[model samples]
Target: MGSCIICGTDVGSGRVCDSHQEDVVFDFRGDSPNGLVPSRFYRGVVDGYAEFGVFVDLVPGVTGLLHRSELDRRLDTLDWEPGDEVFVQVKGVRDNGNVDLGWSIRQAEREFRGVLVQEPAGEHRPDEEPSDDGDDGDTEAETETDESADDDIEVADSVGDGESVDSVGDGESADGDAVEADADPEPTDKDVATDNEESAEVDATLASDGDEDSAVAVNGESDGAADEEVDTDADEETDADRERAPITTLGDAIGESIRIEGEVVGVRQTGGPTVFEVSDETGAVDVAAFVEPGVRAYPDVEVGDAVRVDGEVESHRGDVQVESDGLVLLDGEAAEAVRRRIAEALTDEARPEGLQPLGGDETVAALADDLLDAAEAVRRAVLESRPIVVRHPATADGYVAGAAVERAVLPLIRDEHAKSDAEYHYFTRRPLDEPVYGMDAATNDATRMLQDRDRHDEKLPLFLLVGAGSTTESADGIDLLSVYGVDAVVVDAAVADPETRDAVDTLVSPELADVDGDEGLSTGALVASLASAINDEVRPDLRHLPGASYWTDAPDRYVDLARDAGYDAERVAELREAVALEAYYQSYQDKRELIADLLFSDGGNLAAHVSEQFREKLETEIETADANVATEAVDGVEFALLDTDGYTHRYDFPPTPLLLDDLHRRHADGEPFATVGVGTDELYVRTTADVSVRDVAARAAEIAPTADIDTAGVREGKIEFLSGERDAVEDAVVAAVAEAF
Candidate 1:
C-alpha cells in the first residue's frame, strides 16, 4: 500500500489515490502504446503536425494524436514546435495500437504537486520524491537544521556594516554579548521563522528597486559598479528597463525580444488572439496578444491610439508578427511624439513627384493636378492599410481602365503588407452593369464595409470610381458613401455633370480641365496615365491598354505606344474585341484573371479565339438587320430604320446598341444619314450629326404629346418610350434627327 502525496489517502498500488490522480504528473517509461495507462497525465514531445491534429511522442517510439478538436485554442496558435516538450493526458489505448490524448492545462512540472514514473512492470515513485518534513521524523528535522543555518548566513550578509545582528530579529545574540563556542547552534522554530521573514524582505527590496545602484547589484556588478552604469546608459533603458526596437528592423530580430511604438491602424480578433496592426513611421506590422482563447487582449486600446508593444518577434506562416508580453496605450508627450512622426512620414510618402501622363496625351496632361491628387489618395490608402475598392462599368473601356489601376496597385499592396495574401484582402474590383454608380451599388458596398468593421475591426475602405460615377445620375450613390464618411474618387472620360465634380472627394475628368467633351478621349487612356502616377514601376505593363480600349478611331499616340510595346494593330483590335464580348456575358462579374490574360498576358491564341467569336456574332446580327432596313429621305438627310424586335435576336449577343453602331458604320455611305434600331419599348439613335440623345428625346416628346419619351443612356444615345407608342416614337425620332442635321 502507498499513501497519496496530496491528500494522504491510502491506495492499493501507486503513490497517488484515484481521487488525487489529477494532482500529480506521470512520466511514461513504457516502450509501447499499450503500456500507457488511461486518464494519467504524461509528458510528451511534439513529433510533428497534421491538418486535423498534432502527433506527440509519449515514449521513444510510441506516439499519440492530440486532435485539434481536443485543444483549448486554435491549432495554428499553438507555439509548440517539433521536439518541444508538452503535457497531455493519455485518454485511451485503442485495439489497433493507437493512442488518443486529451489536453492538459498543467504544462509545467512545477504545476503538479508530485510526479511518478509509470513503467511496464508497475507504477512507482520517482527517485527524487518531494520532501515532506512532517512525515520524515528525525531525518527531516536534521535537514531543516542545516537549511536554517544557511538562512542565517544569508541574513547576516544582507545586513550593512556596523548594523547589529539584533536588526535581523530578537532571537539573535545581543550586541557586546559573547556566545560560548560549545553551546548548541541548532535553531528553534521561532529563530528559523524570523530568519525566513528577514530573507524575504531583503529579496523583495532588491527586486522592486529600479535605481541605477540597485540594478548594478542585480546584474552581478562585482566587477565594478561604474562599468555597469556605463553599459546601462548606453542601452537607454526605457519603460520596463528595455530598449525600443523600430518596427522596420523587426525582420532581422525574429526570435528575439523587441519593443515597438506606433499608432494602431487596425485591430482584429481571431479565433485565438487579438491582432493589432500597428503602423510606425517606416512601416506596419501585426502584433498578436492572447488573454485566453478567443478573448480580446488589451481591451482599452483602439484604432488610432498610440501604443507601445513589448513582445518577441516571430514568423507566422511566412508573415512577420509579434507575440506580445505587454501592450500599453500611450498618452501626453509620448502619444503626440508618435502621432507627429506618422503624420510627417505619411505626407512625404503620399505625394508623387514628376507627374507624367502616358502617351503624352494633352488632355490628360492638362488634368495633371487632379490626376496627382487621385494617385496620392490611392498610395496613402495602401500605406495606411486601408482597402481600396474599384468600381467600374462592365465595358471594354471600363475594364481596361480598372485593370490598369489594379495592376499598379496590387504590386504596391504586396510590398506594404507582410502577408502573402494581402493583395487579395486590400484591393477589390467590382463591375457595374451600367455606366452609373446608382443606389444599389452604394448600398451593397456600405453593408459589406459595415459588417467588416463590426466583425474584424477593419478600417473603412476607399472607393475609386473608374470610367463611371461622373454624372448627376450617380450623385445619390456618391452621397450614400459620403454619409458613412467613406471617401470617393471619380476618374472618367465621359461628359461629366458639373454637380458630380462637387459630389466626389476627388474628380479627374477632361471636362474639368477645360477640354471639350467630344475630344474622343477614352477612360482607358485617362486611367492608364493615372495608374502610371500611382505606381511608376508598372508603367511598362499599361502601355498597350489605352489603344485596346477603343473600338474605332483610337488616338494616334496611343496606337504608336501600343506598337512600341510590341502589340500591332491586329493584336490591339483582337484584344478590344475579346474584352467587349466577354464583358457582355458576365455583365456584373469581374473576370480579373481572364481579362488580365487577354489584355496583359502573352496569350495571342486566347485573344484571337475570342475575337473570332465577336466578329462572327456581330456580322450575323448586322446581316439579319440589313435585309429588313427601310429607307426614307427627309430634308436632304437619308434616315434608315430597322424594327430591332423583328429584324434582330432580341435576347442574344450583339445587343441593340452595338448592332445599330455596326450597321450605321457599314451603310452610312458618307452622306447626311442616321440609323435608328427601334425595339419594342426602346430605340437607339446613331447619327453623323452632333446631336445629343436628350435633345432627340425632348423633340420627340413634343411631337407625340401622348407618348412618354426620355433618354435612357446618354452615352449610348438611347431613348425609351411607351411600347404602345413605338411607331409614333420612331417616326418622331427620325424627324428630329433630320431637322438637327
Candidate 2:
C-alpha cells in the first residue's frame, strides 16, 4: 500500500488513492498497449485525424484512437491541432494491440492535483525528492499557485494601508526608523477622500512656497516626500533587474516578467487584447496588452516602431505569448541602435553558405549566384515576419516546385514563431490557371494584400513566382506589384524574354546563366534547389520532387536521386500523373493536404488510385483525337492537323495542351514533323525542327494578313486569331512550321 500524492490518503496498490484516481494525471512510459489502465488519465500528443476519430501518440510507436463518440462535443468542433499535448483516459486495449481512449475533462497538466509516470516497473511521481542542491521537486504549476496566493496577501495588506503593493518594501528612513507593515483595517471611502484632499493641499503648498527646504519639511510630516523618493528608487531598481532577453529564450522564463526590445512587425486587435507581433534578431513573438475587452491597447505602438516591452511570459493554447505590463517606444539613437543590431543579425542569418544544387544538375548549378539571392530573400522574409506568397502555373511541374518550397519553409515558420498556426498565416501557395502572371492575377493579389495591411497592420508580402513569370507577357503584372513596393522573385526554366530580366527584383532562369539552351530543365528542378537553400533540414523530402515534375525524359541524375530517396522510376511517374490530374481539376485551389499525401506519404495506395484515373482519362482523349487526325505535306515536312473544337472534349480532363503533346509523340515519324491542333480562336504548334513560336506567329501574320495572328503562350507555341479567320490562320501556321524546318 502507498499514500496518495494528493491529500495524503492511503491507497491499495498505486500512488493515487481510489477517490483521487481521476484527479492525478499519468505519463505512459510502458512499451505495449496493455500497460494502459482503464479510467486513468494519460497525456498524449495529437498524431493525426480521421473521419471516425483522432489518433494520439502516448509514446513513440504507441498510438490510441480517441473515438468521436467519447467526445463531449462534435468531432469537428475540437480545436486540437496535430502535435498538441492533450489529456485522455484509457478506455480499453483490444486483443489486436489497439488502445482506445476517452476524452478527459481535464486537459492541462495544472488542472490535475498531481502527476505520475506510469512505467513497466512501477508508478512514481516525477522528480519526487529534493536534489543535492537543496531544491524541492516542485512543478511550475505548484510554484505559480503559491506565488499567486502570496500576491493576494500582499494586495490585501496594501489596500488596508492605501499604498501600492510593489512599493511596500524599501530602505529605512534617514533617522534609522525601519518601516513596518500596518495592522489597521481597510480604509473606508470617507477616509480615502480625506487623505486625497490632504495630499492635494500639500502639493499646492509645495508649488506656492518656491522654497525646496521648507517644502521638504512640510512634506516630511505626512511621509509624502519619503514615499515619492521610495517609489522612484523602486522603479529604478526594477529597471536594473530586467536584462534584455532574446525572443527565442522567452519559453524558459514563463510566469516571470522580462524586457524585450524589438521592432513591431505587425499589430492585430482581437476581442480581448491588442496583439503586437514583435521581432528581434533571433525570432518573433506576440505580445498582448489589454485595456478592456475588445478595446485597443498602446494605440501609439504601430508597426515599424522600435520599442521595449515589459511583460510576463505565458503559454496560451500551446503558443508562448507575453502579457504586457508596459510598452515604451524608442527613438533617436536608441531606435537606431536597435535597428542596426537587427539588420546585422538578419544579414548574417539570411546569407546561405553556398549553393549545392540537388542532383548536381549543372544547368541549375550555373545559376548559383541568382538562386542564392532568391533564397536569401525568402529567408529574410520569414525572419522579419513578412508573409510569403507563391504563384505558379497549374501544371505538374509548377505544383512540384511550389510544394517543395512549401515543405521546406513551413518547418522554419513553426520554429521561428511560437504560434502553432504561424505556418498557415505566413506561407501561401496560389496556382494560376494560365502560364502567365497576367493583370487579373496581379490585381487580385494586390487587393488582398492591401486589405491585410490595412486591417491587421501586416507587412507587405514577398511574391515568389515559379514557372509562370519569366516571359515579357508577365511584365505588366510584375510591374503592377512593383508599384505597391512589393518584392517579387521569379524562378523558371523557360527561355525568358531578355526584357523580363529587368522587370522583377530577383530572376533565376537557366537562359540568364549563359548556359546552353538544350538542358531540358523543368521549373521543379530549379525551385527544388532553391528550397534547399532556404532550409537545408528538409532536403531529403525534396529529392524526389525534381524527377516527379517531368512527364518524360527526366535526367539520369534526378532519376537516381529519386531512387536513393526511396522512390522508384515507376512511382515517380505515378506521382507526376496524379499531380497533373489534380492540378487540372482544382486548378485554383492549393489542395495542400491531398497533394502532400500523394507526394510524401509512405503508402502508394493514394498515388495508385489517382494515377489510374489519370491514365484512363488521358487514354480516352488520345483515342478520340487519333481518329480525327489529318495528314498533310508542306515543303517535304509532314504536318498532322486536328480541329480540337470539333473532335475533343473542350472542358474536361486531358486538357487540349496535354492531349496535343501526347498525340504529337505517337504520330511523329522519322522525317521532320509538326502537329497543329486548331481550335475556334486559338491553335497550338508542336514541331520537331528548331522553331520559335514568336517567329512563327510573325511569319503567319504576314501570310494571312486578315487573321490577326499572335502568340498566346511562348513556351507552348500557342497562337490566337479571330474565329472567322480560323481556316486562314491554320493554313498559315502549317506553312510557317514547314518553312522553319
Candidate 3:
C-alpha cells in the first residue's frame, strides 16, 4: 500500500485519495487517454465554437467538448471569444479517446482553492520528507486517513506561487517538509530534526500508541521541561525567520512563507478562524488568524487598520489565502511609514507627459490645467482605495465621456488592488436620464453612501460628475455630497453658472476659459482629453470617442484626429450609433464588460454589427416622423412640429430623443429650423438656430405668465411647461424665438 501524496494516508494505489481527488488538479504528462484524470478542473483555452458547443483546448493535442446540455445559461450570451483563457472540468475520456468537458463556472485562475503539480506514476514523489538520520521515515504504523488532519498542520508564513511539492502528511509538516514527528523536540525549519533523535523517537512512539505518561518519560525529563525547550527553540527560529521573509505581491506569494504589510479592508469570522482581507496596493489576500474554534482572534483590529503580517500562503477554495502566525496592528510611526510607502508608490506613476486637447479649439485647450486637476482627483481616489462614483447624462455624448473615464480608471484600479473584482467595487459609472444633477439623483447617492458607510464601513466615494453637474440646476445635488464632505469633480463642455462653480471641489469647463461661440467642443471630447490625462496608455483608444460625440458639423480637427486613429467618418458614426443603442437597453446597468469590448477590442467588429441594427431602426423611425411633419410659421419663424404620440413608436427601439435627433437632421436643410416632437405630456426641441432653451423658457414664461415654462433639458435644448397650457406655451415659445431672430 502506498501513502497519499496529499495527506500521507494509506491509499490502495493512486497518489491522492478519493476525498481529495476533486480538490486537486494534475498536469497530465502522459500521451494517451489512460493518463487522463477524470472529474478534475483543468486550465483550457477557448479554441472555437460550434453549433453543438464550444471546443476548449486543455493541452496541446488534447481538446474537449463542453456540451450545450451542461451549460448553466444560453451559449450565445457567453462573453468569451476565440483564444480567451477559461477553465473547464474534465468529465471523462471516452473509449474513442475524445474528452468530454463539463462547464466550470470559474473563468479565471484566481478562482481555484489550491494548485498541485501531479507527475506521472514512475516519477519520484517531490514531497517525500527527508530525515537527517539518512533513514526513510516511513513508519510501519497504518497511515491515518482522518480528513481533520489538515487542521493539525500549523503554518506561520506565506509567500510565492503554487506548491512545487505536495500537501502535508500526518503532523510532520504543513507544505511538504518542515516538521517531523520522530525527528526532534526542537526541529529546524528544513528537516525539523532534534539533536536527541533517540529520545524524540521514543516520545513519538509512545504518543502514537496513545500512552499517557510514557510519552513524557523519554530522556528521563519531565513533560513540562520538554515542552519549554520546544517552545523556546521554535520562538527563536520564528523570530529570526521573520527578518528574512521577503515582501512580494499576493499573486506571486502563494504557497511560500513570507511577510506582507497592508491595510485591513474587511474582516469576517469563520467558525474556526477570523479572516482578514488585507490590501497592500499590489493586491489583496485573506489572512486567517486562528486561536480557537468559534472564537474571535485579534479582537482589537478593525477594518481600515494597517497591519504587518507573517504567514504561510495557501489557497482556500480558489482564493489566495494566508495562514497567519503573526499579525501586528501598526500605529504611530509604523502606521505612518506604511501610509507613506503606499502614497509614494501611487504618485510615482505620473500622468501622461505634455498632454494636449484632442480638438483645435483654443478655449478647450486653455482648460488643460483644470482638466489635469480633475484627472489627479481621480488618480488620488484610486490610490487612497476610495470608491469612485461617476455620474453622466443618459445620452450618446454622456455615455462616450463616462466610458472613456471608465476605460482609463478600471485598469488603474486593477493594478492598484489585488482582487480580480476590485474594479466592480472601486469604480462605478451610473447614467442619469437628464443632463442635470437634480435633488432626486443626489438624494439616492447620499442614501446609498450613508448606508455603505454605516454597514460596510466603506469610505465616502469620490463623486465624478461628467457632462451633468456643471449647471446651477444641479446645485442641490452637488450640495448634498458637500454636506458630508465628499469631494466632487465636474467636467462639462457647457458654460456653468457662477453658483454652480461653488458647489463642486474641482470644475473643468471650456466656457471657463472664455471661448467664443458654442462650436468649440463636445462634453465627450473634453472628457476624453481628461481620461487621457488620467491614463495615457489609453489615449489612442480615446481618440475616436471625441469625434463620435458630434452628430453634425463636428470640428475638422477632431474629425482628422479620429481619421488618424484609423476611424473615418463612417466608422465614427457607426460607433456613436452602437453606443446609443446599447445605452437605451438596460439603461441602469453599466454593462462594463460589453462596453469595453465594443470600444477597446480592435477585431470584434462589434461596432459595425450593432450600428447596422441602430441605423435600420433609427432610419425607419425618422422616415415615419418625416412623413408626419407639420409645418407652420410662428411670427415668420419656420417651425417643424411632429406629434410624437401619433407618429413614433413610443415603447420600441430608436427612442423618442434619437428619433427626433434624426428628424431634425433630415429636415434642417440650410434653414433656421426648430423641430418640436411632442409626446404624451413631454416634448423635445432641436434647432439649427443658436437658441438657448433656458433663455427661451424664461422669456416664454413672461410672454405667458401662467405657462410655468422652464428649461427641461439644457443639453437637448428642450423646454418643459404645464402640459394643459401647451398651446399658450408653444405660442409664447414661438414668439420668443421670433423676437430673438
Candidate 4:
C-alpha cells in the first residue's frame, strides 16, 4: 500500500490519496516551483502544456504543470482558461514530508475525502449486544411477478423498477423515443449491475473505451435540433441516415421500405400464432402474426427461407413485432445461414443468469446467498471458522454510523460494538473516500469500479461499509462532516419515491435471491464490501492494554460483554474464524456464480456450444459408420437382422455378472467385445455390421417450437409417422422402418 503523498497515512487499496483539505481557499498564486506536489494546490497558469496532465506550480515558484483534460457532466459548462484560478484543497503531501508543499483541494471536495469510518471504539460482551444480522424481509414486493412483454420468446425482465419515461427527442413523448434504452438503474439488461442511463454510459466507459463519441454527438442535440445536425437537404439521403428506432423488427422495416430483406429460419403455426423466425444478420427478433382463414400459406415456408415481408413494426413492451404486407420467401439454405448469424447477435450484451425473467424474489435470494457466502470466504482466508454477522448499508451515501451497523450484522459482528471495536466500517455504497479492503491497490481499484457503476446508474439506497483491519489518513468524523455529506451526495442517487422502494421490497425479498459478485470481491459482494468494511482479517492481534484506543476514539463497548460472556479467551479465536470464513464463502460463491452464468445464463453461448456438439456427434457417427460399412463390403461380409424380443438384457445368453467377470478376465489379456446379437429362438453374430442407424439417431436433435428451447426438427426421414391404428396401434405390425440396406 502506498502512503498518501499529502499525508504520511496509507492511501488505502486504490493507491489514491484520500487526504482532503475541505477548507480549500481558491487562489491563483503559486507558492512553489518544480510543480507543487501532487494533490497540492492547482496554481492556475496563464501559459502551460494542455490536456489531461495536472498543472502544478514549482515548489515556492510560479512555474506549474498544465493539467488538460475533458470535463465531466459534473463540471457542466465551466470552462477553465489559462491563468484561471480555481479553489482546491490539499489532498496529499509528499510521503518524504520534504518532497513539496502545495495541497490538492479538488479531490477532497469531489467526494474523495476522509478516512474509512470504523466502529465506535468500545468493547462489550459478545452475546450481550443484540445482533440484527439475519434478514427478516418478507415483503409482498418480493413475491410479485412482472408482466412478460414478449411472445414466442419470453424475454428477460428487469430486476429493479423501470425508469420513468419523461422526455424524448423530436418533441414527441418519451414513449416513442429511447424506447429500448430506458432500463432500470440497478441491475442492467444483462444482469450486470449498472447505474442509470447516464451512469451506465460512464460505467461502460470506465477502464474501457465503449462507443461514446457518436452517442454524445446526438445526445448534445435536442429533439428539434437533432434532425438538423445531419445533412437532410440532400435528395440522396438513404435509410441509414434516418434516426434508427431502438426497438424495431425486420417485418416493420420491410413494410416501410422496398428493400425488405432478412433470413427466415423456420415457420410454425401453433396455438393460433403464426410464428416467423427471421433476422437480418444483425439481430434476431421473434415475429408472429395471427393465423387467420384468409392468411396465405406457401407449400414450403419452412426453415432457411430468406423472407421479405412488408409489414408494420411494432414494439410491444419488450418485444419487437412485425406485420406483413407482401411476403416473399427466399431459398431455404440461404435463410438458414442468415438465421444462425442473427442468433449470434443476442450476445451483444452478456446477459447474466440466462434470458429467464429476473424477479425481485430471485434477486433477494441471490443477494442473500452471496452475502452469506462472502462472509464465509473472508473467514476461511483468515483460517478461522466462526459464526460472524454481516452488515450491509441500505444506501450508497455514507458508512453506517456507530456500532449499530456492526450489531446489525449478526454473529459476524457478534455484539453492538464488535465491528466498531474491530475498526471495520459497514457500507452498501462506496465509502466516500476509503479503501475497500485495507490499503491494497487491486482491492481499492475494484471498490472504485463498484462505486462508479452504481453511482452513475442512480440506483440503490447506496452505502459503503468499512470493515476490520482498515486504516486511513484522515478520521471518519472529518469525512462525515465535509466530504461524505457534501461531495458524495447520497440523496441525489435515489431515482424514485417510496413506491419504488416498496416495489423493490416486493421484488427482492430475503427468501429468494441475494447478492453475489466477485470471486473474493466482485458482483454484488462489491456492494456488500462498500456497505460493510472490507477485511483481510488474518493478522496478529493488537495489544489490549488497560485503556486501548477505539476506531471512533472510544473504547469498545462490546469487549466487556465478551469478557462477561466468557469469551475473552476465545474472542481472538472467534474473531479470526469469523473474518476468514466470511472471505472464503463469499469468494467461492462469486466464482461459482460467474462460471454458472457463463455456462447456463442467456448471456452465455451454451446453446451454440450444444448445437455444435450435437452436430459434431452426428458428423462423427456418420463418417465412422460409412468407413466401417465400406470396409465390410470390400471384405465380402454379410449380416442378418434379428428382432430383440422376449430377450431381456438380464439373465440372458451373456449373464451380467458372469459377463462382467469374463470381460475383466479378458481385459487382463487385452481383448475387446465382439459383435453378437440374441433373440428368443436363436443367436446371431457378425464380424461387421452397417451402423448408419447410430449416425442418423445422433442427428435426432429436438428443435425448439418456442423460445428458450430449440431442439426439435422435422424432416422426411426424421419424422415419426404413427401407424393406421394411431394411438391404439399394436406392435405386431410396424408401419415402416426406413433403413439403408
Who wins the TM-score comparison? 2
Encode model 4's per-residue lDDT on 130-219: one tens digit a residue: 124322222233212110111011112211123232332222222454322344222322211111111111011011011222112112
When summed lDDT is taken over every stretch of 10 residues in candidate 3, the lowest stretch is 200-209
Model 2 spans with C-alpha error above 4 angstroms: 1-231
Clash tally, candidates in order: 0, 0, 13, 166
TM-score of each: 0.69, 0.72, 0.69, 0.17
lDDT of each: 0.76, 0.79, 0.69, 0.27
- List ranges where model 4 is wrong by over 4 Å: 1-273, 289-306, 314-320, 326-329, 336-741
Query: After superposing candidate 3, which stretches have Cα over 4 Å from the reference?
Result: 1-250, 266-277, 280-297, 314-321, 350-354, 359-361, 516-518, 602-604
In terms of lDDT, the best-performing candidate is 2
Stretches of candidate 1 off by over 4 Å are 1-246, 516-518, 646-651
RMSD of every prediction: 12.4, 13.0, 10.8, 34.5
lDDT of 4 at 368: 42
List clashing residue pairs in candidate 1.
none
Winner on TM-score between 1 and 2 is 2
Cα displacement (Å) at residue 631, model 1: 3.6
Residue 215 lDDT (model 3): 19
Error of 4 at 237 (Å): 22
Ranking by lDDT: 2, 1, 3, 4
